[model samples]
Target: METPNRQGRRRIVVGITGASGAIYGIRLLRLLRGLDVESHLVMSRSAHLTLNCETELRPADIHALADVVHANGDIGAAIASGSFHADGMIIAPCSIKTLSEIASGVTSSLMSRAADVMLKERRRLVLMVRETPLHAGHLRSMATVTDIGAIVYPPVPAFYARPASLEDMVDYSLGRVLDLFGLEASLAGRWSGVAAKRNPGDAAHVA
Candidate 1:
């Protein structure tokens, strides 16, 4: 059975790596704050560099969104243990290096350690791998993690949602991942029946 935190709130460990899409992690944290979930965040050193390059927010600004912030090097953190009693973990914009470390069961940082704990405890673990032009090595790593019960989620945008902005796209993806943990968020746009759009020279075909 799943356990909530001491305050009767679900706990989720969020990890951000050095991937190009840092906004995914940042927006996820914000979404958690509006829900009844406590977020424990740990970001790799490279994540800070990427965040700086991608946005104007400082590290402190990003850290403030989380309920608890852990150092990546702190392997002995609470979330690193199976007894920490977290609902699950989500590595937003997970980097290839982080994915490889988790897949190999050779966790070097607290983020990966926490992920390992989630797997051992039979808890939900989502890795939003952000990479393109993946080679065979990357595919193999993803398969290995999947075999061990970790969900390999790539944050691919869904144009079917008709997102008006980039934030809409990111929120929808993360919200769907949150659904795996049974935490519902309003950020994700629900898909209904397909709506067709026609142009001046186009004809609609009904089946």
Candidate 2:
């Protein structure tokens, strides 16, 4: 797929819910900043608690990375309406509570409202649900969202990158997610399967 023109930077709404992996949301912001994408952020109350529990960075520090930060309780934010155009929205480390809200079309907070707007506007919506040992409810919720064209991406690691640090792994995961929206990123390693496909005489070998 062709990437959108960069004349104006793409706008992506990012929501950090109460999930345990606040690092995913933080690293996603950093990666989006590096790509020059416009980020609109919303953090739930539970997300604040998780942030305090997981990382040393303050809320202000996290807000600094986004172009605009809206309160999670603010359903009046531009991102919460379909009239506000955005390239897409991502709910990094989406909590089960938030996921259930979205799946059920309950838009109580800015995060859930923005996701609903994304879907209704026919824009891309990616949810990195951070739950394990899924129950039937969780599976059904996922299926419901998937039926509505939202991507349910689990934060799976890529061993092929041979990530040497936490940042490296985060970058790989974020890059892969961004790629789904046709965004180009150099943070993730590329596959070079041509070498494996070649016969000995087919090409000059590299050591």
**Best candidate (score: lDDT):** 1
Candidate 1: RMSD to truth: 3.1
The TM-scores, one per candidate, come to 0.92, 0.88
Total backbone collisions, model 2: 0
lDDT of each: 0.92, 0.87
Best by TM-score: 1
Whole-model lDDT, model 2:
0.87
In model 1, the number of clashes is 0
How does model 1 score by TM-score?
Answer: 0.92
Candidate 2, residues 166-202: lDDT per residue as tens digits? Answer: 8888778888899998787888769876444767776
For model 2, the superposed segments whose C-alpha errors exceed 4 Å read 1-7, 194-207
